[model samples]
Every structure is written in C-alpha cells, then in structure tokens.
Target: MKTSFSSEFAKRYGLYALVTGASEGIGRCFAEELAKAGVNVVLVARREDLLHTLATHLEGTYGVLCPVIGADLASPEQVEDVFQITDQIDVGLIVCNAGFGTAGNFLDGDIDTELNMLSLNCVAVTRMVHHFGLKFKHKGRGGVVLLSSIVATQGVARSAHYAATKAYIQSLGEGLQQEWHGSGVDLLIVAPGPVETGFAKRSNIQLGKSESPDVIARQSLKALGRQKVIRPGVLAKVLSLALSTAPRWLRIKIMSSIMGSMTKQLPQ
Candidate 1:
C-alpha cells in the first residue's frame, strides 16, 4: 500500500469500527462499506457462521481486516463481551443496528419475544451509545448511527411495539446529537422506511419497492460527520412528512391498511 495519509493514518490508528447485526441488513452494509473505506471492521451478530462469512468477504474484497464476534446484544453479558473486545482498539465508528420486529396486533408476538425486540432495539442502542459516547469524548472524535424507522414518526397500529422501539431510538438519537455537538461525537438516527433485505422475511414484513441496504448504508455514512437524522429513500421521507400532518385516526387507519396487505403475504 502506498504510504498516503489515509494508509498512514489507518496503520497508525489501526482504524476500527464496530457494527452490530452485521450478518445482514443495514449493519451488514455498514461493515462492508466501512471496510471498503479502509476501516478495519469488527462485525457482531448472533450467527457466528454467517458473520464469519461476511467478515471473510469483506477482507477478501475490500482488503480491510474484518473480525467477527458472535453475540446476542439483547443479553447484558453478551453486550459486555462486545465492549471487552473493543477495550484496546480505538473504534472511530459504531453502528447500532441490531433489531427485529413483529407486525399485527401487539399480542401477535409473545411477551418474551416483545422483550427481546425491546432489549435489542431500544436498550441495546442506548448501551452502545453510552459506552461509545464516553469513549469518543475521551478520544476526541467518533460517530454513532442508530437504526430507527419511518414508522417511528407515528403510532403504526399494526406495529405498535415495533414502532415504539424505533421511536425510542429516534428520540435518543436527537437528544444525543444535540447534547454531543462540539463534543466530537456525531449521532445519526436512520429512519429507513422499507429496506430490501431478509429483514422482511425474518420479521415477516412485506414492503414493496423497498430501498437496498447499500443505498441506506451510503446515505447513512454521508450523514455521519454531520448533524442530521436520515431516512433511506425519498418516498419514505415524503411519507413520513405527510403522515406528520395527517390526523391521528386517519394515519392509523392508513398504516393498518398497509400492514394488512403486508400480512396477507406472510405465512398464516
């Protein structure tokens, strides 16, 4: 490698990044995109084999070292383990994107399942920001991105719990961004309407004309180093703004109708 400023800085700093849920979706995109930018990536996911494959692909294709950590972020112990691995590295970027959702009535998923989603979406995001925010403060520079949702702007009846969790992420991102400004840490709240990833299959969601993970990931990185919340697609942005002015009952009805169509596509 030529000893350019980038290569020199990367070598001296050992450019590091931590991306949760890296086996798929936005987090996977985050890992690949960062590696493509010459950042050594540490990908965390529950599926060891899948993450290992992703890690190898990034290293082989991007020529950036990618390591995998098998972790269920919903567990405090696992979250701690993730932090321990980063203790010695100067992680300049942290992408908290580990989350899952269940549609239909709030009762569609069991309470235990709901808790898992809550833990992963809201609690885990806060924990990652807390740890990395402090580290960033001490290190003097860093960026954080949290995956929120366009549904977070309103109370989507069919995805009650799911919307609430994303809302928490959105709220946290806004507050942290404001509070951390000039403090050397940038916070990005990503509200992607519908991403074309296995998330639809895993979460049993059906979204037509969804954005790709790469599209969202690129938009997210652009938003970083700047103070702005992000939404993946123009259509999603328009929908979120239109819904903001819509009557509560009407919006719920509209969301419920859309969700109803989605549910019809899923297995019974």
Candidate 2:
C-alpha cells in the first residue's frame, strides 16, 4: 500500500514539528497542515497574542497540542531562548520560516533595517539549522523546510538586501540537502514568488499578481523529500526557468524594470 505524503511526513519526521514565524502567513498555514496530519506543533513568533490565538485554533480544530513561544528571531538572546524553551519537546521537523523583507533603493533604505533583516534571515537561520540539524543527524531521521524567494536568483534592485538574504538561504539549503543525503534526514528549499501576505505592505512594494499562502504551504509540503528545490506556483516556476535561461544582461534589465515599478509605490 502506498503511504500519503502527510502520513509519511509524520512517520519519518516524528510527531512534533516546530515552526518559526508561526503567527501569520505561510508559517501559520504550515502549522495548520501539520496539525491536520496529527502532528503536534510548537509555534514560535514575536507576537504572543497572535501565536496564542493560532495555538488555540489549531488545538480546537485539529485536536493537536500546540505550544506557543514568543521570540524575536533577530535578537541573539531570544533566538537562544527558543531552543531552551523547546528543549523538552522532541521536535522532529523544523520549518525555519521566520524572515522579513525591505524594499526601495539600497542607498535610500535604512542601513540598520537591512542589517536586522540579515540577522534574522541569515544569521538566525544558520543558528537554527545548525542546532536542529545536529539533533536530526544524531537520530538519523527528520526533515527541515527552509523558505527562499523567487527573487533569490538575481539581484533585485529595490529589494537588494531581501533578495540577497533569500539567495543565501537558497544556497544553504542546496548544500545542506546534499550533505544530509543518505543520512536519513531531508532538507527542502522552497522558493515562492509573490504571495498575498503582509510582506508587500511592510516592504512598501507594489506586488503584481500573487497566490494564496495556503497554496504555497501545501505545495511546499508535497515537494518535500521529492525535490531539492521548488518554486511553489506555476508562475513562480516559469519565472525561475526564464531567469535561469535568460542572458545575464537581459535578466538584470527585466528585474530592474520590475523593481522600478515596485519602488514607485513606496511612500515619499
């Protein structure tokens, strides 16, 4: 008999999953999906109220145990505390999905904000992967989902720092997937395009067409173990392919045009 993806995930990765940035967007969807598959989850985010609300909903709807942890991933002390808080919970799967973006000209953008973005998107992610990866390696079973973005393939003009950080994640995930192969652990990097989330508003960018977060989350889970890297939607896949196949000069010009439009939407 063939096993379902959700059940296979639960079985191979164990019964508990920890999701960062679990208060909203794709992170929240991941928690709900895992709960539906009978996996207890530890929800980590900066907004305690939102996390608790989500925990309550998941517990009530799916009958799964959901623990909430409020932590700012950008802060070293808080990121360290996340592991300490979850020390007792046997987290078999980790979705290091906590990250943010910024838009506008690199020179015009606040330097501090960009650095903080790097800390959360790169440094914090590195720490989380290293800490949990060792545990998964020792056990010889578990999985990790690292979030990247379609913009990772090139230098996006207005969102330079954000794109760079995602590029770092993409490379990291690719290398880790190879390193963990045949070791009974799995790593998947999901590079999604624009989604209907708070990201656009926060980044002050005008996003074009976008898909629902639910679609991205579901596709991401199914792609796990099956693919090393995935661009969630058809549009994103097409864009990724085009970027890869296009000449460097053409790609840069195209992305620059897109970024110019997005930047125009930013408040003066």
Candidate 3:
C-alpha cells in the first residue's frame, strides 16, 4: 500500500529528509513514505549494499533523490562522518529510527551489546536532535520523527535496558515538543507496539500481535506536525488504552510478563 501525504507536509518540511536505519524495517518504510510524498531522501545505515539497493528502488519508483550514507550510528566516529556529509545538505526532516533492542535478563545480556545499544539509541539520537534541532529552529521550519516503542512507558523485565533507552527518547521528544512549540519545528514521538519488522529476529524475541511497518510509518508521518506523541496502529492504541489506567507497579508487572513471553523462546 502506498502512503500519501498532504502538500502541506512537503511545504512545511521542505525538499529533503534524512532517515537513519533506512536500510530496512521501519526506517525503510519511513523512507518509502517520505519519498512517496515527493521528498528527496538521504538514507543512512551501516549496510551500504542494502542502502544502495533501496536507493535504487526509491529513486526509480518515486522519482526522488536518495543519497545513501553507510555508517554505524553506534560508533561516535561514524556519527561524525554522517554529520560531515549531512551538513552540506538542507535536510528539513530527520527520522531518528536507527536503534536496536535486547531481550532476556538485563544481567544476562552482553555488556558490549548493551553499551552499544545505549550509544545508538540514546546518544546518537541526542546528537542528531541537538544538531538538527538547532538547524530546524534557526530555519523556523522542520520536522523530527522519533521512533519510540510502547515498552518505553514502563520497565520490562527481559527488555529492561532496551526499554530504558526508548524511555529516554520518549522523555526527550515530549520535552522538545513543548520547548519547540512555537518555533515552527515539529517534533513527533511515535510510540508503537510490536511491529512486523527485522527487530524480532535481531532482538531474538517472538512477537505476539504486531502492526505493519507501513501502518506505523504512514500514521506517524500523517501526525507529524499535528501532535506531540502518537501511539500508531491498532495494536499500539489497544495496548495503550488497556494499560492506561493501571498503576505503575501493575504496569511494570504486566509488561514484564508480556516481555517474558516474547523472549521465552530464546536460548536460556
């Protein structure tokens, strides 16, 4: 299904958008959606081959410019490299969708992997936001899409650190939304539930009911300037509503149980 955006979206955000993690999954979907809107895209990811293939498809199909930047955001040096290239481009929109998650006990997880996750999910996001946030504000028009998860709302046992990272994004996006309210820089935090993406395989977790990446991407773009936070897709909305009134302690336990189920199949 093709996602369509209003002319106002392109007008407000301008010609170019940069999507981190655009090699695959939700990031790829975001890239497709933006390209469908006739916005030129700069695709950023570690896999240069995948990025090139995707760039070809997007450019061929959507007839929009797709510049591929291959860099691991987990590395500080690589992030700097990305900045050097993007600095030359007038990117009016940035989708900070490059992040991974870990499953199983926090203590059981590898220290290196957890640290890497912290760097990519929290640190990299902050850097991008700080750099582009200022640029957008100065220009008085831009858009920022932060991909958070429903797990961000509370602590989950098997996915503690992963959830914590998303919490950081959730808090940051919410704060920036209010801080940049009148600055003509729109900030949207998309807290989606389980999505049908490569995350399940890489994270070594089994999803229950999940939403399509397209649904998440389409809905998020549509809500970019209209709202501060959005729980896109039916699964996300249902989960949010079901847990909204629960006590914090209850939310934690419930989420823990759900996470446990998803990760239970992992080798113990």
Candidate 4:
C-alpha cells in the first residue's frame, strides 16, 4: 500500500483517529488504514476480546498506539464514555461505523432489537458527529466518515428499520457537509452497497454482490477530502444511480423483491 494518501490524510487532519465498530469488517479496515498512515487509533466496539486483539495487531503492525475501548454504542451512557475516553487524545478523525440490521417483516420481528439498531445507527451517530464535529471546527481541522448504505436511497423490505436509520445518516452527513463548509472539517458519507461481512448472519438474510471491507475503506480514504459523498465499487455506483432515477414506488418495489429473495434463503 502507498503511503501518499494515508500520510497526507493524517497530516492534514490530526495524527489521532477514533473508529467506532473497529473490531471487525469495515471499521477494522478503517483502523488499519489509518494506522498505516502513521495515525494512532482509538478503537471502540462492544466486544472486548476483538477490540484488544485488533489493538494489539495494529500496534505491532504499524508501530502506532491503539487504544481499545469496549462500549455498546446503543447505550447513551456508553456513547458518552467513548467521548470521555477520547477527550484527552487529539482525535483528528472519527469514523462512525457502528451499526446493525434486523431482517424480517418489521412488525413480526422483535421490536426491542430494532430499537437498539436505531439507537446505535442513528442516535449514536448524531451525537458523535455533533460533539466531535464541534471540536474539529474549533480546532479548524478534522475529518468525519459516516458509513451509510446504498439501501438508504430508498426503502427496502425485511430491513425497513435498518434502511431508515441509514437514510438518517445519509441526510445528516449531506447537511453537515454544507454546514461545516468553512469550518475546515471534512465530512465524507460513504454509501456502499452490500459488503462481505457477518451482517447477513446477524440479520438472518442472504447478501448480494459485495465488495471487500478493505475495498470500501480504501475508496473512503481516497475520497476523504475530495468529495462529500462516495458510492464505492462499480456495483454500488450503479445501484445508487439507478435508484436515484427510478420512481420511488418502483424503486421500493424492486428493493422489496430483492429483500424477499434474500430473506427466503434463511431458515424460517
């Protein structure tokens, strides 16, 4: 991997980054990418074992400090604890990548789980962006990456709540991009399609054509300061464009059908 973008990115922003959901998948990729760029990382997630393991790996691989903070992002208190942990660190970048999905007819699934997803995906993201965003503005330099999904462009079946939460993220990130225009704080909304992660297993559904976590992470870093929104992978770009042009009703129907197929594969 080339150090040109990574090194330059950390230098322009701060040398320290805070990555939520940093134990696995895309979040892990983000932490690794930043560490490669000579940025120290503060990894936040719910699993202590995974967090400590990843922290150790990054520390040894990149020779950069990696602090592991185990916190369930859905809890308001835990979210605040994350901020407190980073309070003393000069965190220049924040990647809000901690979120999950529930797949089933919305009314049929466990409402409590959906609520938790909402809290983690939307509520937690808003708080982090608001708190850390201000710090970046006062300092006049920083970066924020909010992980959204192509499904956010329209409603999808089986995972309506999850999609809706990402929709909030999409709108929030877009608005913040303009709100912080002159604040020297760059915000990148990463709306990628399905990726090869444990999301399908957790959600109890199948997945479609997906990119690797590292692929999405790389595209995000490349688009960091240059673009406000990025749809990584050719397939993701295509899906985004198609959905944007299609009528809402038709788009929803198509997504519903896609969701139906994926859900059908799971054991009932």
Top candidate, metric TM-score: 3
Cα lDDT tens digits for candidate 3, 1-268:
2234535666798778999999989999999988888888999999999999999998899888999999999998998898899888889999999999999988888999999999999999999999898999999999999989999999988999999999999999989988998999999999999999999989989998889999999999889888889999999899899999999899999999999899987665
Least accurate 10 contiguous residues by lDDT in model 4: 1-10
Candidate 1, 1-268: lDDT as tens digits: 3225345435433488889999988888888777777788899999999999998888888787787899999998899999998888778788898899888677656899889999999888788889988888887777788888887766776678888998888888888878988886777888888888888887777777788889898888767765478777776777777787888788878876777787775443
CA lDDT, every prediction?
0.81, 0.87, 0.91, 0.88
Residue 29, candidate 2: C-alpha displacement in angstroms? 0.9
User: How high is each candidate's TM-score?
Assistant: 0.91, 0.95, 0.96, 0.95
Evaluation by lDDT, superior candidate among 2 and 3: 3
Task: Give per-residue CA lDDT, model 4, range 1-268, as digits (tens).
Answer: 3367557866788778899999889999998988887788899998989989998888888788998899999999999998898899999999999888888888888889989999999999999998998899999999999999888878998779888999999999988888889888999999988889877788888887878999998899889989989999888888777788889989889888888888996434
lDDT score, candidate 3: 0.91
Error of 1 at 149 (Å): 0.4
Segments of candidate 4 deviating more than 4 angstroms: 266-268
Number of backbone clashes in candidate 3: 0
- Indicate which candidate wins on lDDT: 3
Off by over 4 Å in 2: 1-7
**TM-score-sorted candidate list, best first:** 3, 4, 2, 1
| Stretch of 10 with least lDDT, candidate 2 | 1-10
For model 1, the superposed segments whose C-alpha errors exceed 4 Å read: 1-14, 247-249, 265-268
Q: What's the residue-level lDDT of 105 in candidate 2?
A: 78
